[model samples]
Target: MRLSGRAALAVGLAGAVLAPVTPAFAAPPPVTADLRADVDRNGRVDITGTGDQTGEDTWSAGRGAVFLPNIDDDAKRCRTTGPDGKPLSDAKLAKCNDAADTTVNGAADAKDLARLRTVPMAQAPKDASGTVRVTGKGAKHARLFIKRAGGWTAVTAKTTLTAAELRAGVELGLEGTDVVRDRAVWDGSAVVELKVTAGSTTTSDKVTLHVAPLLTQHHLQRAQRMLVTEIQGKGPFSRAQQKFVKDLDTQAKKAGVKQSTVKFTKYGDIWAQDFVEPAYAGMTGEDGRPRTIRIMLRSAQPDREAGRELFEKLRGPDMGVVQVTGVKDSEEWTLNSMGNLETIPPYTHGGRSYPAGRIIMGERKDTGSKPAKAMRTLLASQGLQNPLFLDTSWLHVGHVDEFVQFLPAPGTPRGWRIGVADPDAGMKLLRDAKAAGHGKTKMFSVKGFEGMPAPKETIDQTLADKKLRADNALAAKRIKANLEVLKRETGVTDAEIVRVPALFTRGTDEGVAADRMPLLRRIGGSADTPEAVREYGQQRELGKPTGPSVMTSAYVPGAVNGVLLGPDRYLAPRQWGPVIGGKDIFTQAVTAAYRKAGFKVSYIDDYYTYHLGMGEVHCGTNTLRDTTKPWWRP
Candidate 1:
């Protein structure tokens, strides 16, 4: 039962005053004692005390007290009825008498009940197979007490010390065959008080215990290492791709950055960053060292096999691997770590709190309501108070990195700013390039088409240009809609969003006649056949039927999909231009925009494989960063 401060005080005072007190005299020689408490290798607190004294002694223990001030009047002892059926009004009188008794006994005053120093206590260490050793000297007898929600209780079953081993001038072990063996008192922190009295002289000592936590995952500091994978020459990587890798390595070396490159196998595993999540904990490893654990997500079979390979190659006693089950795709795990918070997609069951507490997820209008509700419930059950959910279904690839990114910005009002892709801004640059006589090139004029028939020399390119413009306009509208949703959900103003120029494009379908011509080598038979000329003439009349396409970024690798190397450095995809009437305008504008926001931009070419596969540089790499702040504070 819970007790009011006054009620607790009344009860304590009643016991102390009613007990008999021996007559006071000149204090005997001061007792000398030493106390030590240590946790050993057994997850137990082994306490011992040793001291010396002369003559017969009396041993006692005083428990620590917790008092609450300004208690309700109705709960005060003075306002309550006593056993005599009368209102108890002797609280002040009892305190005065108790103070007199303390003065008579030559002990510390008991007038102020709130500031009593009874016994010291500490939290136990949470490490496995560890023990706490507590020793005390200069005391003849020792008593141990553990604090709980109700109050302090003696470590031994009996209140009085009856064993000779527990008497003064002897080394006493508090827990073992001779002492209490209950596991309850050993769980939390304990307070041990040793008191020895010789010929009316008494001395006491107290010591506290503390235990450290085993796991912690709420810190996101500077990145310590950049992780990449070899291309293995499996996909179509041009010389530009090779140059991009060389440039990246050169820059990294110049910065003295450490890197880990996973050897590429024949298996299709180019994106190393999207598979795992690194979480730090305070537990000792098998080799008695502390480190982080890599929590990998397995989606498809190939991806799972690749993840297992990495895990087996890198796993250690300190650096372990944990697999997250039932994930829809690896893209769902592409999260932004923000110290105590992580931005991820809602795709898991309830009760799993990853990367610490707070989570920011996105909601798609296309996903059914029941699934969304279940995901929300799962997140809430994991103690995520207010998760930020954005609408990302408008884009062809519904991933947050395709549109938004968070980076360190010391100069901004907040320490960081969110970068959002702006297709409208990209279209504006394209329009300016077209006005300067850049967008007049026909689709048939594009290089690397051996079998396609030559386009009519007199054909006008205006319709093709208009179709491209229409695609960009549609992309701009979708991007605007997503921005509105982000602003409404995140409460981040437009001023805070750094608009990066980017665009999107739809994949070409093979069934369409226009789509098939670009990939075909010849429409009819060989040059020897007479029908070849006639077939070519007829094909010209079909005339690139207003191109079937969708909304895609102007740049092949989206601008927003770039990776932030650090607070001041960013690595983006290199855009080859002069395709949309804009010769390198997309790259130039993107570089200028990032530079204006206090970041030095480095362009890395990914056109051959990564861009073609609908990804960017950030999607292909991962980083291990140091955590600067504590999760509890944020």
Candidate 2:
């Protein structure tokens, strides 16, 4: 009869067998009496039995033993109890003199009883896959069962173990596939119980199966969903900004990908760029199973309320958010294609370790400083062997994204490649444009500020030309140095590097200059006052009274600061009709470059919303990739 629910079974036997000893007196037969058992779904077993022997019988309970051949050493034996409902001493338990003698067993073995024996079963690891192969001796004709809420449920129909296979000692595939469909049943791990019956004796063994966690970012898979914050332009959306969002939605729809728009009210909150960095830390749950998602957030920002609201909307069983204690923004963190998270060490509350599968990559610099030491300790504890460190102090905003990015390209030898912004390449394009009669292009044409006096006009024109040369030269030098560092540390070759056109400028001391100007500019004053011109030149001391400032577009908005949607798709910043290369060459060059690199480029015009704020398309957007790849393969 099949046993279901929480009910137990009890069998009573009243048979006696005679034992041979002395010939003179006849010995009473040993009695086999009632056997009561309670087996729970959680592998708890309890048994109680009684035996009676009377008149000249040298029969003792010690001579007979109860055997549980299948339980492991941890749960192999049963303790004896007295009639008073208390555990009996081993010495007192040995004397079974009366007909009413009884033997009681505990849930698990405690006395190391001689009759109880464990089966030699190959148990799987705690984090084993859904399907585990259980193999061992005496496994033939075994019945597999899974522990459920009400009681143990037999899974022989779903299992792939035949009598022949078990007899041959072949591994039996225990199926726990229902975990995917019934998540509430199995919290990442399941227990498989195998009951094997040989003749009249039955034995059981158990194994735990674990399921792998979800992958968030890595070369394992490409992003299928793009996340963008809805433009609530406190400054009012420019035509370009409006078109950018519309084009993004159009492209996403065409690619069969979903575009998730995070809503916010505040103007400063619209720059979702600095809020949270979506990452999967591969953390384990309370039951020792991998957690699905962990969203890393920045501790310091201009608008925390906006980020918090967005995080609340995004948090679910498959996703969670963790705020980093010492970091100012998520721009300090970057996840490479190899599943390695690169981050800068924060000042306070930084040192924390992560799990094994997810690698943390950090850079060590300025060991003498307290913040640097803190960062070093954090990265060291987090299990990074050799972190990639580059000097970003020269740039107004020091971030890895400003200079480097990783792209997926199956056609490449490594199946991936790195894109580095080349200021020199941008300068070369600028020089070519100037040579082709584009030098006279008006640099800045604000409505109220047009048609200035002779000295201002000359100074503006000179400063614009000089700023381009100085900024490009400094940026190129820095890029060269950084490239060397990257090559030495990561072993990435120049052939695998895609040089994208980009430029940088410094922020002024007073923070007024939108773009930096060169130190030298000959301002021609009125021809009447030579003395006035000399005094003006002395007061200026070349051009800048203060220092250099943040990066601004000379000809177009940040072209290289585009988003890589997938292997074949890219979203580049549209030029907004900027006169570069003697024509509107920003769109033409950027599009051609991406297309040449085997990407279908989609131009996004974020000139007014993001570019005016010294950021680009990528700064305003993010992507949550598909985690279909099996992490075990990596």
Best by the TM-score measure: 2
Per model, how many backbone clashes are there? 44, 8
Estimate every model's Cα lDDT from 0 to 1. 0.40, 0.40
lDDT of 1: 0.40
Cα TM-score per model: 0.52, 0.53
Residue 278's lDDT within candidate 2 is: 55
Error of 1 at 108 (Å): 47
**Model 1 residue 440 lDDT score:** 54
